[model samples]
Target: MCRWAADLGDAIFLEDVIAAPSHSLIAQSSHAREAKSPTNADGFGVAWYGDRPEPGLYRDILPAWSDSNLRSLGRQIKSGLFLAHVRASTGGATSRLNCHPFTSGRWSFMHNGQIGGFEKIRRRLENALSDDLFDQLEGATDSELLFRLMIGEGLSSDPYGAVSRVTSRVIEASRVAGIEPSLKLTAAFSDGEALHAVRYATDDHAPTLYTAAFAKRAGRCVVSEPFDRDGRIWREIPQSSFVTMTRDGTSIRPFAPATTRWALAS
Candidate 1:
């Protein structure tokens, strides 16, 4: 969706994918078939990349469905590359800062799923981040923390490698805490050029991630569930896989974390 043809010659609107779809992000907020929390009423956020390197961000502690601005803005704003998230609290306080699609410089990220016992190891994970990344942190959610950790793990240069390293560390920490030792997640991140996503877990299930091409338009969309009623069009990413989407096309490959211990630079 990074082509210059924003909204693909005006056939698709932002809301058309976020709010209007049958199993849209708004619908998944209420009864997600694969999410840990069915009710994503804690908060919502959207990050859209425009001409600038950094993406524009909007977040509020309201369910996406209840947010009038979200609807209004979605209808008006047009972007080829954007990400919207409806959050269901999973061991984090409900607040604007705790929302998804956390931003750092030009990078934007959003996630679905949870760490088995985030509370027990949150501090450890936080401690691993460098001072600069720690200073940018404003929320206590594991999703934001993971973004920063990915940054610390070298997201700017090695996006998927960073994610894999961080996931390995988190799962190792959870095991030490006598928790489930699982890091179940489906996440997407971008640096305003191409979008990268991963679906990985130490458990039996990984949160669902799917992508569908526009029928009448010239864009692609990735979602937690099928964006439209016709599930046949959406292709689910395989478990433990990495996907990279660009103006050229999308590519998928097997994904897994680095088993080596992760130690951030001081």
Candidate 2:
């Protein structure tokens, strides 16, 4: 699994979350406290929205802790919304193309879990994407595919429902292939105006996720774990839940697959 941090708040330097905290994303790259694996050294990526229609992205195959360039860039860039990820590949080659914070137009996404038997279901998932979405894909990771699949399923109109439909498809496909449904997904994404995150799995063993609401600002942060050990500052998101953070505030609610058995059986 991987570790990631997403901040949707005041326009501050990216380094505040990516490298400044005592247990920042850069620190998690070397010694993660909550992931199944301790070292997420395969690569790292950061994305933040700016004045352009699309978000700016910086990704590399170097481990976050070892990359001085990342530290320098983090200190310089400022944005109201930023996402940073440290990867520990369960599948796919260790390349920049395989890094996190995958982007499409104004949307950026990052994931902290793996789909069970992704290799078996990769073709099925790819075939389900629209031609336009398929063309947008530049990497071979299931994480990126999930993002495009959500877009094909109407993410721009209904972000939460689109993700539910995509996860339902992954679960159903794994079952048909005789693979144990072990889809551990805790993902965060943004469409420039708002951020959406989900902590869910086929079973109860979802990867860890947390969120912190700023006391003074109308903003919230979604992260794999609290950057610091302040229980008062962060709330561990419940299993099988969804979160949305916007300029107004933050909201949390239960989440379930939207696809019905009739639809799957048909």
Candidate 3:
């Protein structure tokens, strides 16, 4: 698994979210407190939306703790919405192209989870993608593949529904391959406007996810873990739920892929 953060609201420098906190994304690169492993040194990436329809992206194959470029960018770049991720390779090769916050025309996505038995079901999932989306794939990681799968299922117009379908399909594929605990995910994405996130798993255990609203700070953010130990600064997003955030506020609702699957079947 990996660690990530997403922020939306008043414009602010990226450093405020990625590097300045008590347990910032940069610090998590080498000493993540919540993930299964303490070190997520595979790679890292950041995507931020400004005035442009498409977001600006910066990624490197270096460990985030040792990357001077990452620090420099964090301190200099600012945005109203952004996402940063520190990778801990589940199975994919460690490379810049494989970094998180994968982007398309106007959408950016990042995930902290794994597609169980990915190698066994990889071809099935890839084959389900539309030619255009499949062709757009630039990395070999399941995370990227999952992004494209969402696109294929209509992410451009319906993120929640698209993701629900993708999750159901992933679980079905995993079952066919006889893999237990088909998936684990706590993922976030934005379309240069509002942000949508989900926390779900094939079984009862889901990766940790949380959202914080700083009444006196930059705004609201969703993260893999609370940046500070201050309980007042954050709230845990319940397992098997979908959260949506905009400048106005944040809301979360129950999420169940089985409901989505049943809908698809009928």
TM-score to true structure, per model? 0.90, 0.95, 0.95
Locate the minimum summed-lDDT window of 10 residues in model 2.
Answer: 257-266
Question: Candidate 3 at residue 137, lDDT?
Answer: 93
TM-score of 1: 0.90
In model 2, how large is the Cα lDDT of residue 109?
94
Give the total clashing residue pairs for model 2: 0
lDDT of 1 by residue, 1-266 (tens): 00000122223457876777676777767777765556778888888887799999998998877889988988987777888888877777888998877898999988887787788888888888789989999988788899989999999999888998898889777766667786777888888788888888888598788876766666676778765655337788899999888877789999987879754322
Candidate 2 colliding pairs: none
Summarize candidate 2's per-residue lDDT along 100-158 as a digit string, tens digits: 99998889999999898999878878888778888999888999999999999889999
Off by over 4 Å in 1: 1-12, 178-180, 230-232, 262-266
- Tens digit per residue, CA lDDT, model 3, 1-266: 89999999888899987888888998888888888999999999999999899999999899998999888988888899999999999988998999998999999999999988899889878878888998999999999999998888898898888888889888877766667647898999999999999999887688899998886664799999887765436789999999999889999998877444321121
Clashes of each: 0, 0, 0
Q: What is the C-alpha RMSD of each candidate to the true structure, in Å?
A: 4.2, 2.0, 2.6
